[model samples]
Target: MYGKKYLFFISFCILIIVASGCTIGESPAEKMYEHLEQTVSLESGFAEVQEPLIEAEQKEQELFNEMLGLSMKEIDKIKKLADEAIGLADSRGELITKEKESIDSAYEEFKSVNGLVDEIDEDTLKKKANELVETMEKRYKSYDDLHNVYMEALNMDRELYEMMKKEDLAIEDLKSRTEKLNKKYEEVLKSQDAFNNLTDQYNEKKKAFYKEAGFSTTDKKEAS
Candidate 1:
């Protein structure tokens, strides 16, 4: 009877060992790092697409300044530069659409991650996570708002330029339209400044998070 009982107990232990395998859950810091990595990657991609638009605008401005002192013979170069800038904007539509979708999806994941992150043993780290999430939400929303207004202004400016070229209008009429376009541009600039400031704050918070996790902050640059 004793022999049979001992054999039965050993079989039970073997079955239990076979049924339960070793498993490891990710630490809170690891989870946050993954989220940060994805967010930064998406932002970097968007910024790469956006860089050409910015450079084109700068080149256009330089051409405009040079054209001011030159004769009408130089107007062709200015027009070419302007067209290039507009083309840059047009070509980025698909990229921007994809980036918007990606960022939005990431933002949703960030929200879900927030709940899990509270389990972190460190109270300060949890608080920082909450702050970072809130800042990111605001930053993305402001960025979207600023981009919409900037595109609207760009389209209107182009339309006004075409109207001036294709049809003769009174000085007063053109002036009124120009003033309106200037106002729209001003609005876009204001939005951009706001967006930039928010982005800076986000970068600072991100650096703080990395520091808290004992990760290197030097490799993380601010995404524009």
Candidate 2:
């Protein structure tokens, strides 16, 4: 069974406020930050959707373990567990789709900031903004890769469950499938690591960009 990897949500505490004598006009950096905030806001449901999925996967793992000890005479119990596992896999698929849609929406919202980047007047700030955009793009791509690999592993898990329901299932066949599932999970872990690394990089670059743009930021933990 695959273990759950918790994804870090990107967040910041940049203070956006108008000074007492300042005009109502918003700077380009402020506008860009607004769009970025909207992008991050779209991902607020990520944990809500992900938790149930993880729980479902854990339940399926328990089912797999239970099925292992059943004899041919207990085939009815085996089929019942297999059916439950299949249903869990289907539910997981739906949750994953929702997860993908959430990220896709965030990516679309983030894309709006690319145009705003050019409006930044300060050369150094503009350069940093560009770097931030590029890193975010890469982070989004890494997540997509992670999603694909995870879905592949999910399908493999489902196939293994289906095999379990078969009466004449060969031990060698089950062994082979289990090996493949393990390898697929290894790939999933690798992809997950890549996504997390990119996310960390993006967060650091984003903080630097905010600082260079004169946005007063405090770490969220500090504020708390």
Candidate 3:
């Protein structure tokens, strides 16, 4: 009976040690090894070691799912915003080209009228040239103003694109963190399982040792 109690105590203690060592990102078996190395005692060394590793593994998975889901959603939204920006830039380019063509036409007409220098009065020709130049100046100024407006539109689009870039970077960081967590969990889980196997081996050895020593197996077995 006494031997059985001792075996039961040892089994319970081992379970506790393993559970304690196990943490998030760690394997159950790995944690058990750590517990044994740190606190070598019947009461402390064999306590639960698998607890933390198990919890960490679950949390890592949850974080990965959440971050990936949110990032994908945001990527779709940013793509739409980029499309709108490209459209705005294209519209501005068209407007600028039209303004340039109008200016060119007016300048050509003014040159043709001035070329009739011998057929027309000097004063009349001069007046017409001045008017043409003035009209061109007004049109040119209007083009400049419109160009500025278009640029402002482009700037707004750029701001949104930059925001999207920043968001993507954040999502990338989340991915990195999750990956590291996965590695930790792999190691910890491996250790946890190993520790459990070791404990089983120890139990078998203990029983065999008692039997070989001519200890009363029935007495210890009955106690446990």
Candidate 4:
């Protein structure tokens, strides 16, 4: 009878151990780790959303470059390319704006968390998270710069159409618009460089945190 009782006791103890182990699996550290994963995911998604805009911008650039190769007499071709470029910009502009706003909201939500996971209780870790957020915030400036470039293109398109409608187009005006557009593109490039640097830093810091916290930093999209 005592042997049977001992056996039952051993089984009961094993069950309790397993139960506690499962409970312990969901720790503050794990919660924080999950939150960080969410942040990284959102950032990566934003980058993907930007790809279309980047492609469209490149197309617009090619059109602009082609304009430089042609003579002022190729006004019809210039007008057509400008119209196509404008169409591309118009189609993507709203989507980019919407995606940026969505990502901004996600970051805002993350910032609102009283404390993200137990690991963030550490001053250094919290500071790193904050810095990452700041960099993410700074990325908006690139969008602003890009908008300026877009606006310039739109204005140039309007002005060019006006000039093309005339019997005798002013070569000087077309040349001036092209020069101004190129200058604006240069500004956009600079902003893009800054944005890219920040993105690299954001990814590095995110990976470091995930490493320290024992989370899988691999992106799900990439894994697939």
Candidate 5:
């Protein structure tokens, strides 16, 4: 009878141990280990997802800053040209209709560049959280010397157009210069047009870039 009682007590202890663990057939140590392993796996998975996002965001931001620094250098050059044009226009009989049109076109291009540069702070920063602002500043000076040459050409087109229109200039000389001026003028227009188009494309392409990055852009426009 004492043996029977002790056997009952041992069986009860085993039942209690089984009930304390989560599963029917599993031991407490095994279940505890499984729970700990699952916790670590979840933490690892979460980190894996976050790490790439942070890296991609940084890459995208670097590109953006590169682009913006290129833009600000561009803006400064354009501003200088605009100021020169404005000063020249103030002079007597300095600007005519076609020359004025070229000046207007150049001014418009400046405005477009200015607008894009101005949008960099809140809108772009929010979208490109990991971007390096300092990197863009470093890139700005490199593009300046190259971009200045193109800006100079834009100014020359306006100036040459005015020079040839002088009443003192002979028709033969004007005729000869006209072809060359027109060619240079066309090239300048083409470059300015490209810059304008790129700005527009960049704005529209934001949605696509954001979508690819798994961040939803407002309105979520589909990429073509």
Candidate 6:
């Protein structure tokens, strides 16, 4: 009877060890998913901040159009509009700078997941996670490109306004500067489009990764 009791005690100890192993905190995959979700949440304000930037740009464009219709003889009017335009450009620049900072923060947060990716046990999941990281990095790079081009366009715009304030501004100089500014804007548009496309692609890839990894898709934020 004592031998049988000893055997039962050994089995009970083995069962406790197995259960403790199972209950020891979140799995590696779960930890990585939670980290990724936190990184995504950091970008939640991105779209919200963009609205004010758009409004500021629109105001600047209206001021530019109004200034274009004024004659050189209206020097005071031209200077006033030019000052207003310069101020608007400065404000727009501030908004863009803030937006860039937000993206930079998100990028840094996303990059922290590299160690978590390494901890993932499943080969396929690890590969998918790495791919998600690559796409997100590309998306951030694309935004950086767009931000540079847009800031260049804003600077050109400020230069054009400063030229307008000059009483002796040459018609040819104005025309050339305006043309160059338009071209710069065209480049900005192209960069914006590229950034947008990469963002969409990254979102899709992230959604797919979440689904494949068996993460909950019910959270609308994660669904994005």
Q: Is candidate 4 or candidate 6 better by lDDT?
A: 6
TM-score to true structure, per model? 0.69, 0.87, 0.30, 0.62, 0.29, 0.83
- Tell me how far the alpha carbon of residue 43 in candidate 5 is from the true structure, in angstroms, after superposition: 41
Estimate the TM-score for candidate 2. Answer: 0.87
Provide backbone clash counts, one per model. 0, 0, 42, 0, 0, 0
**Candidate with better TM-score, 1 vs 6:** 6
The weakest ten consecutive residues by lDDT in model 5 span 5-14
Candidate 4 lDDT (Cα, whole model)?
Answer: 0.51
RMSD of each: 21.1, 4.6, 41.6, 19.2, 32.1, 19.9
**Tens-digit per-residue lDDT, 53-75, candidate 3:** 23432443343233334544576
Q: Write the per-residue lDDT of candidate 6 for residues 48-151, one digit (tens) a residue.
A: 56667666677777777777778889889989988998897898788777767767887787777777888888888888888878888897898788888888
Per-residue lDDT for 112-148 in model 5, tens only? Answer: 3222333334454334322212222222322232234
lDDT of 6 at 119: 82
Clash count, predicted structure 3: 42
Candidate 6 local lDDT, residue 25: 46
User: Whole-model Cα lDDT per candidate?
Assistant: 0.56, 0.75, 0.37, 0.51, 0.33, 0.68
Runs with alpha carbons beyond 4 Å of true place in candidate 4? 1-30, 43-55, 58-82, 113-119, 140-166, 216-224
TM-score of 4: 0.62
lDDT tens digits, residues 64-128, model 4?
56655666678678678767766765755664566566566556655643355334666666666
Q: Which of candidates 2 and 6 reaches a greater TM-score?
A: 2
- State how far residue 96 of model 6 sits from its true place (Å): 1.0
Q: Can you list the residue pairs that collide in candidate 5?
A: none
Q: Clashes in candidate 2: how many?
A: 0
Which is the better candidate, 3 or 5, if ranked by TM-score? 3
Better of 4 and 6 by TM-score: 6
